[model samples]
Target: MRNYGVVIPAFNASGTIAETLLSVAAQTVRPELVVIVDDGSTDDLASAISGTELPIHLLRQANSGPGSATTRGIAALSTPLIATLDADDLWLPNKMERQIAHLERFPTTSGVFCHWRNFRNDRPDAPEAEAVPGWSRTTMMIRREVAETVGPIVDPPGGRGEMIDWIARVREAGLALDMLDEVLARRRIRPGSLSYGRDPARDRGYLQVARLAMLRRARDKAGSG
Candidate 1:
């Protein structure tokens, strides 16, 4: 199996990060390296991760959005293959194994992503939701070279819709991401999370990123014609 590293971007994720790292440790195919970028979290993120024995490389920076933290964590790794996991998400035990298998089978694909299920903490540490076919950075495994080609993940204000912008850039760069039908990651829905609250600003951020994506597409089409 190819050696791979994991990047986790954390911001005030103390309550949920330990479980997240445990999921990583429970992976059927272990990662060669794990880097956690602490995005200036006011909470005790370090204390939370100290209980785990995983050889985690922790980096700290002023409160940057997930995109910046992700970029920093990815830059710290030297592995040929890189995967990302959000600090509040959980990966199924075979997530790495399945994604790696997919990448090996489709050698020309830029990356591999799997479906994710959203769960709530109604019962504490339990997933109380059905699986859904969706794309999330947490479910992605890609070659290091592909990440370089896709460029940095954009950090939009409020840390909303960065992934949408990045995916648009990926398509613009003529890259393809192969996705599996199976759900291999679980996203936690919690109060006060960036995506949970009914915040108008979040909606605006998403719309802004999408608009930029549309403009980029139009510009590329015109340039080509």
Candidate 2:
């Protein structure tokens, strides 16, 4: 089995960090290491994980966007495979087991991602809604080589679109990403969450990343020719 580590970039996630950590602790296939990058959060994030028996490495940095925090966390880990979990999301117990099994079965694929469900924190009793069907960071597990090839996620000025940017780079590199049809995580959409609402700046950043990828592809083709 491939050794894996989990990185969680958290910022002011006092209310939900415990739940996130607990979910990770309950995974059937626990990660070799768990690193939580606290991006200058004023909240009691450290206190939340203080008593947990999970092998966690808590790193605190100056106020940085999630992209930078994630990059730092990834750099600190030595595991061959890395899985990311949002501070507000919860992974199903078999998430790591299933993804790792898929990667082991298909050696050619660079990574595997599964579907996710979105649940509103305010409506605890309501049924969870399915996220748009596709590969997402919340449900992604990738080999270290794939992440190194893609490089760090870009932290936009507005602090969003980093994952989108990274995914675009992954595609440009011609990496094969396999999808697992099962839902492996639950995304929490709460009020005041950075990822809860739409932002035009993030949309523009996505376009910019795509444009850069296209330009790079063109340059590579020209060089090959």
Q: Among these predicted structures, which one has the highest lDDT?
A: 1
Instruction: Give, for candidate 2, the lowest lDDT window spanning 10 residues.
Output: 122-131
TM-score of each: 0.95, 0.91
Per-residue CA lDDT of candidate 2, range 89-143, in tens?
Answer: 8888999999999999999899889887788874433537655544666788999
Model 1 residue 213 lDDT?
Answer: 84
Please report the candidate that would top TM-score against the real structure: 1
Q: lDDT (0-100) at residue 60 of candidate 2?
A: 98
lDDT per residue for candidate 1 within 1-225, as digits (tens), equals 489999999999999899999999999999998999999999999999997868899999999799889989999999989999889888999999998988888888878888887788433356655766656679888889877988899887667888778877887788878889888898888898876867887667798897898898788899999
Off by over 4 Å in 2: 122-127, 221-225
Pairs in clash, predicted candidate 1: none
